[model samples]
Target: MAIPTIRVGLTAATRTMAGTSAVPKYSDKENGIIATDRETGEKLYTVMIFLMEEDRAETLKVTVPANGLPNGLKPGMPVKTVDLVARPWANLFNGQISSGVAYRVSALELDSGE
Candidate 1:
């Protein structure tokens, strides 16, 4: 059976650090997996975003292929998550099961002229 995923799009602030090394570092075998670009064979990184709605605030962490994110993206910069999807995952841990949403995006671009 295929896992169902939700497609979502919204304007949010990029909370991840911005620089030549904006991507977070992780061991190749950490979490029993390694993230890489399939077509370009490049490493991937996780980006954090903050969504502010009225008085409620939420945060999401998404993985982006190396150099996949748009340039000039910085902290507190308004941006849009292009082709964003949320996949639900469940795993057995110790003696219990846990589940959460994993986010991915094809690109992150500045939400200008909004």
Candidate 2:
């Protein structure tokens, strides 16, 4: 069972945008093993959410399944994004603001035959 853990504290982003080589907000090292209901033997892995300086309040969030999740995740639920980028807009007042929530995408991984 691959456990979802929280990564160590990282540096904050500056007012200016960073290059492509910028480090990630969270890493696999922060994940850990957790216990769920004892009698039912049901367990769920919990992963940490990261909010970096570059990640504006409006940035989109997405969650992707690893090698687990047999039934697959639900759409419009919530998940972290595989990658983050500022949406392009001409002016500051344009659709540049961000919400603090992340959206979900389904049928990404986990299937009998790809």
How close to the true structure is residue 11 of candidate 1, measured as C-alpha lDDT?
A: 44
Candidate 1 local lDDT, 1-114, one digit each (tens): 776889975545422332232465354665745567666776777878876666666777887776667776677766666787999999998989998998877777776735
- Candidate 2 residues 1-114, lDDT tens each? 432333323243412111121112233435744443333444433223334356553323333233223243343223323222222223345668644433222213222221
Scored by lDDT, model 2 comes in at: 0.31
The 0-to-1 C-alpha lDDT of every candidate, in the order given, reads: 0.69, 0.31
Give me the runs in candidate 2 sitting further than 4 Å from their true place. 1-31, 34-59, 67-99, 109-114
Q: TM-score of the candidate numbered 2?
A: 0.19
> What are the clash counts of all predictions, listed in order?
0, 12
Angstrom error at residue 72, model 1: 3.0
